[model samples]
Target: MVSKLKMVLIFISIPVISLFAQDKPELHVGGALRFNYNLSSWKEGQKTRGGDFGYDLFRINAKAKYKGVKLNAEYRLYSQGFGGGMLKQGWVGYDFTPENNLQIGLTQVPFGITQYNSHNWFFSINYYLGLEDDHDMGLKYTHNSENWLYAFAFFKNAEELNFGNNSDVSNSRYSYDVSSSGDGLYRNKEINQLNLKVVRKFSNGGANHMLGVSAQYGGIYNLDTENTGDHLALAGHYELDFGKLNVKAQVSKYNYNTKNPAGQSNDMIAMTAYGAPYLVASEGTTYTLGVAYSVPVEWGPISNLQFYDDFGFMDKKLNDFHDSYMNVTGVLITAGNVYTYVDAAQGKDQPWLGPVWGGALSEGTANADWEMRFNINIGYYF
Candidate 1:
């Protein structure tokens, strides 16, 4: 099947190349190699057994621009002790303007702070940002202006990353032993997603501020279990400069749903919503606040030299409104700082490496007493 797909892509690329070859344009290709090391404390039986040194990302990206059309492809390879492999996202985009385009193919839905933010790469924020997954097969349209921007995407089911009620016994191979947002998170034969986002900027002379709104609806049609949910999110970001001090704040909320019927899992039977008609799977909201003080290296050849630190927190409230017995709450906090480098010639690339520490606390008979992680990550784009 993989060979067949590759053949189809090759056939499609031939005609596309022929059409673009007439324009005589420039082709640019590049990628990055990144590594991460975790000095985390762990307990036996925990799913995330820490691998000391992990090749976080090794990717190659190719893009060709001709006339008003652009074609891009990215392939990534990752490895840890368990094993790793490769995946690719190949898409074609046509620009209506220099800053506006309609792109179709596999892509990332730009919905939340962490969705498009690259600064937090070295430190995985699965526990904090609720944006742990990667790109999916989809069609996306994007528009950007000076002070306002928006995007919308339609997607197919990408189930490898779902958790919480969405991963029930019938739909997922794994047992529904643990509970979280995707508890019964399973996709039937039919799965699709629609995501939309809009953002407006504000300023008071010092620096700009942003207000963002996002929404996503995913459909799952399976007879055994219906795994459908919607996500609504709102956020704000502000940047202020006062002589030698800089401050910023950001926050977001994510609400999703899933299901677990009676006698499915031992844990499922104990939940209040088991016998109820509608089950309230799981939901959570998270936020981030940060501040930094920096001074330029006056005589040095450095660009914008600065020192910074940020604090982040996330809280999850999980319960079936119909089933209170299966209820729990989870909280997390993290603090980190890094040396940020800036270079205009590098385009959107920013290199940051830092030490980050965080801890997880939960109540209501969910899983463990507590889970914590400490890691150092270095990331850059070329």
Candidate 2:
């Protein structure tokens, strides 16, 4: 059934391509294929180091524009099967002015660093916390100026799709698990999120700086229990860029409050059994620091090279739980349209940091205090 649906979508694209070709509509077609190789090690009496090869995913992105109106979409086929296939992002927007626009449909929530600086395929720990690359069904308005930017949005649902449910017995395999705003705390809820930033550009000095603030307020509902939960977050971030080096950092504090005390067991925001999710402290503060340096020299088959280090720390509000942190160091090499990432990472109680090798907090693993892993990802875009 899923294969047939995929075929139908593919056939439908043919005519769309023809329409663009005939009308000369602004259109583009491109995508990327990625692969991963993993090796891992565990604590005593636990699984030893092992290796595996897997397909990360295949994506097709298309965009079309006519005057001030634009349409964009991305379709994906995941090796692990994302609800048969997934629509990563699909949206339409109209530009009232070059600096202002209104967008509707599924799009990324405007919050935090739009993209994290990580060499490995997996994003930073913020991703697992619904703070990065998180998309939702909503309406959004954005404004940009020479020295300022702002965004406001309302989402009908936290997330539009997922692979698991509350009764699934185990959430270990779901892409988002409990941290998902839609299914876990804010299930069947409404979310309003906003972001604002101020920028200072130094044209002659070859540098730029930005300071931003973000906030979110939402509610959650459960049909069976008639229970309601609330989600709230406030964050501030800073960014600096020099010709060859860049720095990105953020500090955020949030709360997942529930009307019924019973919900407290799952009150923890973005709780993943292993990885960074394990580090969440119900009502705590989270901080991220990332730095990258681009090398000037380029050699054969490698047009660009960069080295980066990213770190995250979570301080729980409760005194009994331990603070959590993770550090990743890696190099990114790009040759033409092909890119490769090689990285090593270590974390204390941060399972999502080493998702491929599995994390210490992952189910069925001996609870190790610390974990480490090495990874390589190769991808091509055209």
Candidate 3:
């Protein structure tokens, strides 16, 4: 009698579920959980303490669509890299045609390579200077064709982080945003920015190439002086794919002209992220070059491997300021929903790689020795 009653309830719910599925608006939610292990050469204590292994992050990805309207959002909680849980990006968009769309709210800026310029996890050095993979509160229009892509955006400013008792809560967000110099010396913020990006893609002799150019202009508002200065960045990038090998190259230049409160030097600007504020050179040129090769494997549950080498450099024009350099060699392994990266990274006068924790992007040390970090990151995706 109990089995018969359970069968009757199942028979009733299948059609009910099918009915709602046919008419309901579409929604999808997914996320990832990641962890990290690292041993740094610069941290001498870690040598005796053994390498550190810890939680990295857990992030949510959500998308919803109804008719022509769409919504996309991603939020993350970090165990190490952020002050607290933060919204990575959230936007609402509309599709007017099959080839074009518009997005408004906290959206990605169309500048210097659409998604990334590096193959390894540490991104290009340009990311540290606020020139790559940066998002802002903005509106953007994008159009795509078989051989061409274009995007234009107008940003009111960077995402405003929560401020508590401090006069200026500098960091606590993804991507670099101008803040204070930590000493009462300088104050500036990103505002009123415009971006334009165009890409041309072509295929020849079984090889595909993508060439792109991006331009940006923005305001740097000073909190103490109440005057708005300006900042500009321009970049060009090229990518190629032949069989299982990929190559990426980009060059970018940036300038920051800020109006400070009387005694600040124009040669350096203050930028913040991850709950800390630091200085960066006011003017610099950056370059990125990367290459990767992939192979399919059948080692038990392991399915694929990608080996890559990515290099980035920053050239500061200020007098006596040393440049920054980075290179990462790594392999990415995939097994169904589990993915992992094994990387050996080295850098000189670089921030996260580290002998210098602050201002390494600004006036770097004089011919510093290279530092190394052996790291592994693993994640499970849903």
Candidate 4:
């Protein structure tokens, strides 16, 4: 059977070819190569281990256009431990009018904030909750005006690299999604998801502001039970930009109603990325806050500097679960085509900051110490 990605392309080609047959096509290509270095307090002897810097990732972006029809795609290559090669996103779209269009294939789900909800190297906690920068195999419709915008989408599932939720659900994915556990003890997949986002853009007192709301509902397929449970989420987001200063805030509540096998817990579900799976609380409300200011600098090879701090907190509905929190204070330096992020990120019960890889979004442990990581990510784009 053809994979979902291939199926969508096959189903849409005929009309796309005919609709834009008379126009000349245009193509563009670009991408980036990045590297990372970090030191974590939770590691007993990370520095002594003689390990700190390594290749992060390399990605290629391509865009093709023919009149009203367009295609966009990005593919990435990562270290084996980071899930190897993966297609970040690929979509075909058609413009029905200047104000609206439709996109199909692996596309972004409009939610919480546009591209990202954080201003630092370490994203806000919403990302771990699977509510930020999430993408899936779907079709999205969007319409916009001078100050008002709306988007609606229907996702069959998260990008399906393989057919089923087997022992090894391919972790060659860009965004976090519910999936089989690395141990294969837990198995589930996202399906039949619907999403809606609306934004109102305005300015007052010389400051531009945006207020938006997003809602999503979806099914969680339990491979063990052969039954489908559902998930629901709602969010309110706001942003402000004044001169060189910016402020952002958002609150979101999410519930994962999973249909697990007998004797299993329903209070948590598994999500995977970079070939590792971890548990996230089944129900919670997450909050985010961030502020940043950019200033031009005269330092040689450095054109600008941006200082920012982003904070995130999560409160689980279950009384017994410990809450989670994260904060990243950093500066971004831009010089020509090179950009670097230097961050001091701290978190409690967050997986990336911990000694191990998995358990980034799980129920926190009592007396868990806040872990701090000093990180620098540098990339060159062309």
lDDT of 4 at 80: 90
For model 2, where is the 10-residue window of minimal lDDT? 356-365
1 or 3: which has the higher TM-score?
3
- List, residue by residue over 1-382, the lDDT tens digit for candidate 4: 5699898898899788876675878899999999999988877688677449999999999999887699999999999988899888899999898889899999988998878899997789988778888889999999987898899999998988786435345677878899877665568889899999999999889999889999999999888788999999999999999999999899999999999998778988888887677888899999999999999998999999999999999998888888888999999999999999999999987888765345546667877788999999999988
lDDT of 2 by residue, 151-206 (tens): 88887654444434442112222233234233444223333444343333333467
Assess each prediction's global lDDT (C-alpha) against the native: 0.45, 0.63, 0.88, 0.88
Give per-residue CA lDDT, model 1, range 1-382, as digits (tens).
9999999999999988988775887689987666665542332433265436666667788999887688888776655321243344678899888668888775665655434332233322222232423355678888888887788888774423444443432222111111222333222322477777787766776665666766666643332455343444455544455666655555555444334333442111111111111122234454544455555553443334454444454455644221111111111112122222221111000011111111121122223223333444444456
Model 1 misplaced regions, further than 4 Å: 1-22, 43-54, 80-83, 114-118, 122-134, 159-190, 221-223, 226-248, 259-261, 264-281, 292-306, 319-374, 379-381
Clash counts for the predictions, in order = 16, 5, 0, 1
Candidate 4: worst 10 consecutive residues by lDDT? 163-172
What would the TM-scores of all predictions be?
0.60, 0.78, 0.92, 0.92
lDDT of candidate 3 at residue 14, scale 0 to 100 = 100
The TM-score between candidate 4 and the true structure equals 0.92
Model 2 misplacement above 4 A: 1-24, 43-50, 81-84, 117-120, 162-204, 260-266, 269-281, 354-368
| lDDT, residue 278, model 2 | 37
Tell me model 4's lDDT, rounded to 2 decimals: 0.88
